[model samples]
Target: MKTFLEVKQLNKTFQPDKEVEVTALRNINIAVKQGDFAVLSGPSGSGKTTLLNIIGGLDEATGGEVLLSGQVLTGLSEKELSIIRRDQIGFVFQAYNLIPVLTAKENIEYVMRLQGRNQEECDTRVMEVARKLEIETLLNKLPSQLSGGQQQRVAVARAVAATPKPHSC
Candidate 1:
């Protein structure tokens, strides 16, 4: 079996100036096989988000490599990274970053639309995930109209609707 995600000697550093430097991550290593479940748990300020951002292509690592299903993500151009992110990774952000104007259903359908899926397919997948997540009744509601848990559920539904795509931290 091949690794779905791999990180090796991952290092991240922040240098604001000659006198100021902070190391967020150093020599981090991780591997996850396809269909496996893994978790990253730590207290605040533990570089968890920094590591995640680098893995998701939302941030650059100062050193090391990230491989997603065997594709090296470190040196890819922004557009290339964007394509990988769109087609290969689904992110459920901590803040539940739903578009304020779009209803739950629309928010859930957004990624599918970006993937160039037809309306019928997007709608079917959205409904399927909504049902699975028990958020079908909240589809018409705006993000502000739902509770935190509901918003999180919708976010999860949106992430899951983009099925067969690997999810990032």
Candidate 2:
């Protein structure tokens, strides 16, 4: 099968000042084919989050490329990257990142709404994902009202609900 995700020569560097440069990642590479599962495991400060941020289009690498399917994500305009992120990437942040004002149901529906999906579709997807995640009972609760575990579950639900299957490569 073709590679579903590829990271080629990935490098990330941080320069806090002209006199100081910290290399976070260097010459990193990864490939995951369709239906494959992979994990990034490392101690803190080992660039795991940095790598993920680049892959998820939340950050840019100082060097290298991230490709999803066959599309190169390097050097895209911010607007283009935003569209790609919205349409393709799903992130479950370390922090739940839920909007405090929106209930769990609305958090799950937020991306679908941004994608311009109709209300019926958003409602249907929210219900479906909430049921699959066993968060149906928590739908009306705001993030502030949920426990840490519940918030994480809702975060996962939101990511799963927003991420559409990749188009044919």
Of candidate 1, the 10-residue stretch with the lowest lDDT total is 160-169
Most accurate candidate by TM-score: 2
Per-residue lDDT over 94-140 for candidate 1, one digit per residue giving the tens place of the 0 to 100 score:
89999999999999999889999999999888988898899999999
In angstroms, the error of model 2 at 75 is: 0.4
Q: Residue 34 deviation, candidate 1, in Å?
A: 0.7
List ranges where model 2 is wrong by over 4 Å.
165-169
What is the C-alpha lDDT profile of model 2 across 31-103, one tens digit per residue?
9998788989999999999899999888999999999989999999899999988988888988989999999
For model 2, what is the alpha-carbon lDDT of residue 142? 95
Residue runs of model 1 more than 4 Å from their true location after superposition:
163-169
TM-score to true structure, per model: 0.93, 0.94
Model 1 alpha-carbon miss at residue 26, Å? 0.7
